[model samples]
Target: MASETIPITVEFTGGLEMLFADQRKHSLSVPAKDERGQAVTVGWLVHYLCVEVMKDPRKEMFVLDGHVRPGILVLINDADWELEGEASYALQARDNILFVSTLHGG
Candidate 1:
């Protein structure tokens, strides 16, 4: 059987959207589980955005060492991602995920 998909909204702000085809928000349907049938987490969503959605080559600006780079804040459903287990948080249908960059070049 085909894997189930969850629909979620992803938003980028504080200039991070430039890397994602200059778009600030994306609505996507992603697999509910990994190949091993484990629930899909925010970690997986990050990778998906980098590889599938982002059109800019500056991936390092959004992620570093396989994780969201420092100075970028992740919010899940209007709350800080830290309060929601960060990258380990399982994605839910209609969830809203936002990434905001805090670094500014002078």
Candidate 2:
């Protein structure tokens, strides 16, 4: 049987939207589990963004060393991702994930 996909909304702001063609919000779906059969978390979503969604070559601006780069803020369903377990937060249907960049300049 095939696992159901989880639909979620992704948004970027505070300059990070530049990497996504200046489109701040995107709606997409992802598998419910990873290849290891674990629930897809924010970390997985980050990788998905780099590999699938984002068209620009500046992946390092969104991820660094396998994680969301510092100076960037992530919010889950309107709450800080830290409170939702950060990267380990399991994605849910219709969940809204937002990434805001704090860095300045080009």
Candidate 3:
């Protein structure tokens, strides 16, 4: 039978870890498909992180208007998310997704 989930590594940096239970790295097995029964994409992962992983209430710091806030860089497997089709990129097993916040409070 096909696996129901896919393994992935998510890293938070540039002070973003504070929003994720103060952890820098997380090893997770996410659903292989979303509620729509489609391949899970980076966008789905983002929502998962916010709802299932993030413990802090300051969600706006990481996401805004249902999307990653500006100044946060998303890297997929060491490459820019933009190069990988941004949020539309389909998640693969063992993929590493990194979120780096470029905005820092003074």
Q: Per-residue lDDT for 3-106 in model 1, tens only?
A: 79999999999989888888899999999997778899999999988898988999999999999999999999999999999999999999999999999553
Root-mean-square deviation of candidate 2? 1.5
lDDT of 2 at 56: 99
Q: Taking the tens digit of each residue's C-alpha lDDT, what string does model 3 give over 6-33? A: 9999999999999998899999999998
* Estimated TM-score for each candidate: 0.95, 0.93, 0.95
Superior candidate under TM-score, 2 versus 3: 3
Q: Which has the higher lDDT value, candidate number 2 or candidate number 3?
A: 3
Question: lDDT score of model 2?
Answer: 0.93
Which regions in candidate 3 have their CA more than 4 angstroms from the true location?
Answer: 1-3
lDDT of each: 0.93, 0.93, 0.95
After TM-score superposition, the amount by which residue 26's alpha carbon in candidate 1 deviates from its true location, in angstroms, is 0.3
RMSD of 1: 1.3
Residue 48 lDDT, candidate 3, scale 0-100: 94
User: Model 3: how large is the Cα RMSD against the reference?
Assistant: 1.7
